[model samples]
Target: MNPPVFKPRLSTSYLIVDDHALVREGIVRVVTNTWPHAHLSHAASLHEANKLLAEPGASFDTVVLDLNLGDSDGIQTLKTLRAAAPMARVAVVSANNDLDLALACLHEGACAFIPKMGSIDHFVRGLQTLASGGTYFPRDLLAQAQQREGAPTGVQPVAAISLTPRQHEVLHLLLQGLTNTLIAQELGISAETVKLHVSAILRSYGVANRVQLLLVCAGQDDSTAPQTH
Candidate 1:
């Protein structure tokens, strides 16, 4: 029997943001190889990224970002991109391996953090996961995060919470790093309804946002103590 051929489940549209030409080209090559039919765009700085994102008909499934761009740096870069393209999953590809920074990126809405020092295969796998509606955080960073002291306390597991069927659906998509607008489209519901469900889900988890909920789900921390509904 022949070995099975690998194929991506979806044709993704990607926006690669990096100030370094070589790094950007390397990511573009990896993405092209992994998903041969994928659509790709590029931005060398935060300003350029914002311009592309603001263009009419601009839409991307994922954004590969570097935190140390000439015009921006640190978690703020991820935050800016998140604001500009709320629907696109932002994956931070950086040389920095600081666990706190990685957690901060996740907390601020980045779906994945890919270390630029990692192997090509690692990058490929991260891209694959993101393309399939999943979030990717490096295991080493997650392990360090688990050992950190900042996780919330007293938060309950996801199964311990009572959730409506629709809320459950929304939660599933949310964990996959989809924005409210994306989840609304997926569930064929209004964004406001999705937002309500998200808020309820956060309350049930005793967390304030998706990142805290993710940490709780991953058994990271519960320092974010429960809030009364």
Candidate 2:
């Protein structure tokens, strides 16, 4: 024999947690279309989800959760489910279009963030992306987020795209070596929101990480820097 061939794992099991029966049906439709042989399970509350997870041999390859469950806290539910089934890829299907919340879900171990208002095609794409082990954030969501950042304020960059005002604040604080949590506390925003801003900042600067950003900003004059709050 020349060699042994390795096959990719096919995702055949899924768990959907949402209080609304209609929403669960819609997601199940998407799943059926995408993976016709997939075994689907539904839970309306965190309690039900935990009960299912506690089953001795019951496990799903993927989990799609709602952020606003009838009996669960916001992102805490996602965190709990993630902790319970560490092997399953979690995706947040929420009505909340807040980019901050979406990013927060990702930070909390969700592999994908899908807004409920998206088209059927969008849902199919998101599910496929997650099942294939790639992180998915809708292209339109990223575009909308960047557009909402608006024009840059305070420090102007030599590069084409300037930093947004919030991003400028985040960058300045970051230059001071403030951690994300501290920056969130100082700015009166959630740490998840700060992470989104920081990610945008890094993208705008074309830097791989904070150290590179610091090196790029090292040459800039301090006179034009905005005063920290």
TM per candidate comes to 0.71, 0.59
lDDT at residue 200 of model 1 (Cα atoms): 88
lDDT string, candidate 2, 180-213, tens digits: 8877987899999999999987787666555445
Off by over 4 Å in 1: 1-11, 149-169, 176-209, 212-229
Worst 10 residues of 2 by lDDT: 220-229
Model 1 accuracy (lDDT, Cα): 0.74
| Pairs in clash, predicted candidate 2 | none
Local distance difference test, per candidate? Answer: 0.74, 0.69
Write model 1 residue lDDT over 76-135, tens digit each, in one string: 888888888776777888899888888888777777778877677777776666665556
Model 2 misses residue 228 by how many Å?
46
What is the RMSD, in Å, between candidate 2 and the native fold over all Cα? 13.6
The number of the candidate with the highest lDDT is 1
- Candidate 1's displacement at residue 174, Å, is 1.9
